[model samples]
Target chain A: GAGVSQSPRYKVAKRGQDVALRCDPISGHVSLFWYQQALGQGPEFLTYFQNEAQLDKSGLPSDRFFAERPEGSVSTLKIQRTQQEDSAVYLCASSLGASAGGNIQYFGAGTRLSVL
Target chain B: AQTVTQSQPEMSVQEAETVTLSCTYDTSESDYYLFWYKQPPSRQMILVIRQEAYKQQNATENRFSVNFQKAAKSFSLKISDSQLGDAAMYFCAYWGGANSKLTFGKGITLSVRP
Candidate 1:
């Protein structure tokens, strides 16, 4: 693909429902990141992956949030028992560099999730 | 941890005029990166410009330039010859070397009046 692609550009979930967001990064990107953006706020880091290894998951807000990139090219973010606070835009980005130091991330259009 | 702050919640600039957006960051690490991202109504995040913390010189991309004051922990963006299309939400971001996670500031909404 020419750019990072995300599925279900918009999703509306009732509170306590489980939802999954998918991200298809640019071909061969080594680093993948997940972020959450609340209304009128900047994106907040959620997790990071290098290849198939999950290097950081410190930013995940709670146990309900889980992300995985098993093969390293495609990733999924699953939220269990979604709360109203979970209503936000979930963004996915990928970069060629393994580390963040010199990497320029390419972002997807993001999936706007609304938890009623 | 690095924290980026953009104090201006909203700013307006006339067409052909220049507007400066303010940003300040707090970081103890000597080596890192600063970035400016623009998100239009379409909600696509676009990279505007970037500056390396180790470099003394600023960064420029077309009509976008950054005034990076390493000492003051400030990285402000200046948009020259602004156009109506430049209207968007601008964010300042910080990336610590060796980490993929980026810390971003509360964005500033830019309005370009024609």
Candidate 2:
């Protein structure tokens, strides 16, 4: 893709329902990241991946939030038993991994998840 | 721990005028990266400009530039000749090191008036 792409630009999920958000990064992008942006707030880091390896998961809010990039080309963020507080925009970004020239991260039009 | 702060929740600027958005961050790391990103109503976050901690010179991009004060831990974005299209949410972010995750501030909503 020309830029980072996220699926289901808007999601309305009922509490306790499972929701899966997808991200398609730029071709051959070595690094991918997931962020959650609450209403009236900036995006907060959730997890990062270098290739298929999950280098950091420390920022994941809870056990209910999980992300994976199994093949490194695409990624998925799954939320199990969603809560009302989970309502926010889920953003995905990609960059050249492990290179000094890859500092700029390109973001996608995030998926707005509204849990009711 | 690194923390970025944007005190202004909202700002307005007349078209073709200049405006600056304030940002302050605290970081123990000697070398890191600071960035400004713009998010329009479409919700796509785009990088506006960036500054490296080691760089004594401020970073600039066309109409967008940054007044980076390493000692003061202040990084403010100045948009010259602001345009109506410039209306959006501006975010100040910090990265500890290369390939590090970003820490962002609360963000400021910029309204450009024609």
List the pairs of residues colliding in candidate 2: none
- List chain B TM-scores, each candidate: 0.97, 0.97
The parts of candidate 2 lying over 4 Å away from their true place are: A99-102
Q: Which DockQ values do the candidates obtain, in the order shown?
A: 0.85, 0.65
Q: Per model, how many backbone clashes are there?
A: 0, 0
lDDT of 1 by residue, B2-104 (tens): 7899999999999999999999999888999999999998787999999999999999999999999999999999999999999999999998855668899
Each candidate's TM vs. the true structure? 0.98, 0.97
Chain A alone, model 1, TM-score?
Answer: 0.98
> What is the docking quality class of candidate 1?
high
In terms of lDDT, model 2 sits at 0.92
Per-residue lDDT value at B24 in model 2: 100
| Tens digits of per-residue lDDT for model 2, A1-116 | 89999999999999999999999999988989999999999999899998999988888999999999999889999999999999999999999764233368899999999998
